[model samples]
Target: MSEQSTTDSIVSFVLENKLKTILYTWAAGITGSLAYEWSRPIPGSLKIIHSRVYAQAITLAALGSVAAVEMYQATHHPDKVKKVDKHGY
Candidate 1:
C-alpha cells in the first residue's frame, strides 16, 4: 500500500479527535453569527416557526443538549473516547 501523504495524515489526526471537531464547528458558528449581524433579512422570509429569534433559541438548545451528552459520556464511558493524559507535561 502507498504511504499516507502529509495532508491525509493531518486530516485523519484532526477527525480522530472528537472534541476538536465540535470546537471547530463552534468557531465557524461565531463567524456565521457575525455575518448574520451585518446582513439584512431577506424579503418574505419570515414564518411563524422560522423567525430569527426562534431559530437562535433552538440552536442554543441543541448545543446545550450536545454538551450534556458529551459530559455524560466522558464521565460514564471514558473509554469510548480517546484517552489522554490530563496532566502530562
Candidate 2:
C-alpha cells in the first residue's frame, strides 16, 4: 500500500472540507489584519475595541453570506455537488 505524503494529506483535507477551510482562512486573515492595525501607534482618543468588534461583526456577516450561497447551490444544483463528491475536483 502506498502512503500519502503530508502535502497530499493536507490537500485532501482542504478539498474535503472546503467551506471549513475557507472560514478558517478568512478568520485568520481578519485576525492578522487586526493584529497589524493594533501594532501601530494608537491615535489619541481613538477606540480600538470598537474597531475590533466591527471587524468581528463583518467577518461573521461574510461567513454567513458564504454559507447561504453554499446552501443555495447545494439545494439548487445537487447533481453538480454529487459529481464533485464522487470524483475529486
- Point out the worst 10-residue segment of candidate 1 by lDDT: 42-51
Put down candidate 1 lDDT per residue, 1-89, tens digits, no spaces.
Answer: 99988854644454355456556555555456545644645443443223445446545754665566656656765776555597721
- Steric collisions counted per model: 0, 0
Candidate 1 error regions (>4 Å):
1-50, 83-89
Write model 2 residue lDDT over 1-89, tens digit each, in one string.
99988855664565467678667766675677566667678862343564566567766765676566556557765654445554544
Q: Looking at candidate 2, what is the lDDT of residue 41?
A: 86
The residue pairs in collision within model 2 are none
TM-score of each: 0.39, 0.47
Clashing pairs in 1: none
Q: Please report how far candidate 2 places residue 30 from its true position, in Å.
A: 0.9
